[model samples]
Target: MTHPQIIARCHPALEALLPKPTAARAALPDWLRAMPSEAPAETLNGDPVRTLKHCPPFLDALSLGILIPLATDLHFDKGAVSWDWDPPALPDTLISRSPIALHLPEQATGAPYPLAVNSILKFLNFWTLEAPSGTSLLFTHPLNREELPFRTLSGVVDCDLFRDGYVHFPALWLDRDFTGTLPAGTPIAQVIPLPRSAPPELTVTTMTEAQITANRALQTDLATTPGTYRKRFRH
Candidate 1:
């Protein structure tokens, strides 16, 4: 039978038994099996663990793994799912409550979900594959991501060197519905990069030394002048 049909029928069965999936699967590490995505259970993969301990593990446990999509690891990290605006409080190598913010077509209705990133830097592109043109991707980070914090805020996607380079911006800026600006908490992944070369007619504009001196002198004269009408100064 097809996987979808199989999963549809089996979900009720799994929910009925409500067995301790983690305890059932002996092979997986504890973090791998105890994901809260499926049920009310302790979190897994928030940090490195000794081992996985679950019957099925994340998507693997769903409907006897009949409908578990290929590359499940890429779609869902071995951890919790959340929509928290606050930056996750994570150790260098740990899972905090965060989702990868994949840009997709707008939904028919309802607010969007929150996404998170591990503070530790890692290479996202390494984990990414091709997606449909309209499909924005959110990379679910496993707690293991914490262990290998990218030595830098690595980009999974190619970007402009200037606009996308290593720079720490304020977190408050991330929440804005930015126009001609990056989104709040916008990760290194989904950046709208700038061009590398200057335009033919490009020119640098700055206040001249003469202008700066004139402005400073004007300010000083105003501060020193009396409140009453003052005599005009000779050049």
Candidate 2:
């Protein structure tokens, strides 16, 4: 679909979260060459119909390590939100949903890129059960990457928190990219394994405000000076 189509069909929340779509469509292919282009599926009715999969053009146009601050602020477990100073806790599931991953620096200090949410929304919305199972949706950058590994998660928010222009997204679902062998037609996304990734014990202590300010600096660099940094994560 074209850029206009993406904007028109996307959730208002997504539009509000991203910067303007400034990357030219022509430059996208090379920037996202590592991401898989298709999700493998056996079509029903005994015929396979190749459906198009999507990722945020924003991500497609930039490297993964540019949007780090948002990712840094998204650490949560047991209903507590805090920053850790160890290696990040990237998500892993054994089922294959699609090929996608967020990049992180080998060390706890790093940044994130401003990727398109429409593509991200497409990847995570594969979940079948949930209040918003089939809605056109996307999460805030921090919430999507750290709080909710998969974007299609659904749950209720208290009206008071939601009414004041703030909402806490408690993730109950995620479309994890599976990297293991599996039987055919498994509907749920497979858990992606992370042997090469850092261990769970790793942590990075950070202040919320400081991380956000740092993250903004990185985003600015990504938009204006695409160079000045190298790839810090391994695929």
Candidate 3:
């Protein structure tokens, strides 16, 4: 099968200095790597059951697409944020020197974010992404990255049509007490390119006799088999 290509463009001078976007699989979190596939647990029969480490869907969601990493190390102390990145001199004056930006409290006055921080922070993306002609890019917080101190706001952009400009990510600072460095290579966003075709119409109906029978068989298999979905359903 042919795969669609996604391109990332940045200043030629900062090519080596900046952390390039990476595949989500290549950037799995440390906690995930340290987790065991199975641990001592109590099932109904007192047997050890599989953990999320052995779950394909959870792993697949974390490995879905490309991850856009922070270009520089971000330091947060008290309520202050700072970075220490010095990019090579470039002719383009439009590029941002700082790794982050801010949105005033008034800008998000009525927003329903869980956090009560006075301002919204944005990760400055220096790279421009280009997807296939008929696709858009879904930009969201890195999947299953709940350990991070902020929640990135989700957005969809017609990247195929809007590849000329940068797409910064806005996030709510969830931990005001978090004071440390978010390393330069930390993933800030996950980008998944999806086709622009409209989805099929929704249909609501009662299950047919065959469908009910199939559901019963599936349930029985799930109860009896350890890896039924992994062995037969997952591609």
Candidate 4:
């Protein structure tokens, strides 16, 4: 079966220097890669209980999309952020010189988000993303990446319709005390392409006898059988 294509385009000068967007599965966190699927836990009577490695849905979520990496190395020290990348010279009218930008605090005034005093950092995208026709792209923080010092805000764009312009990501700098280098190729965002469609119709009703029986059976399987969802339901 043929799969839909998602294309990332960038200037020829940056083709070799910039880190290309990668499959999410290829970029799993180091800690997760080292974790065992099951480990003996003293709290569980020394039983070998399943860990997140055994969770299909969680793993699927982490591997579902393409991860966009940081274009250059960034350093944070004493509340300042700096980068040392010297991108190849291009036309003056071309992309911004810096790999980052910022949304002033005033822009987020009165917003409910907690870090209102801080400016929202933007990861400037030198590469433009293009998805298949009738598909929209979801730009979000990399799932389960709490180790990062910042959290990227989420947005949706009809890449099929607006593929020419750069879609910079705005993120909240969460760790004020964090002082270190965020290396180049660190995943800054996850992009998932989805079909553009109307919202599903909502329904509210009491469960029928068959539905109740099915729910009971599912609960029983969940409690009694290991990997039931992985073996029987996951595709």
lDDT of each: 0.27, 0.29, 0.89, 0.89
Could you give the candidate ranking by lDDT, starting with the highest? Answer: 4, 3, 2, 1
Question: Which lDDT tens digits does candidate 3 get at residues 95-209?
Answer: 7777899898788768777654678999999999999999999999999999988888999999999988899999989988778999988899999989999788999999999
Compute each candidate's TM-score over C-alphas.
Answer: 0.17, 0.19, 0.94, 0.95
* RMSD per model, one decimal: 25.2, 23.9, 1.7, 1.6
- Screening candidate 4 with a backbone cut-off below 3 angstroms (N, C-alpha, C), the clashing residue pairs are none
| Candidate 1 TM-score, true structure as reference | 0.17
- Give the per-residue Cα lDDT of candidate 4 at 107: 90
Instruction: Report the Cα lDDT for residue 159, model 2.
Output: 26
Q: What lDDT score is found at residue 87 in candidate 3?
A: 80
Q: Scored by Cα lDDT, where does model 4 land?
A: 0.89
TM-score of 2: 0.19
What's the residue-level lDDT of 201 in candidate 1? 92
Between prediction 1 and prediction 4, the one with superior TM-score is 4
Angstrom error at residue 79, model 4: 1.7
Ranking by TM-score: 4, 3, 2, 1
Model 4, 138-234: lDDT tens digits are: 9999998889888999999999988887889999988777789999999899999889889899999999999999999999999999989999999
What's the TM for model 3?
Answer: 0.94
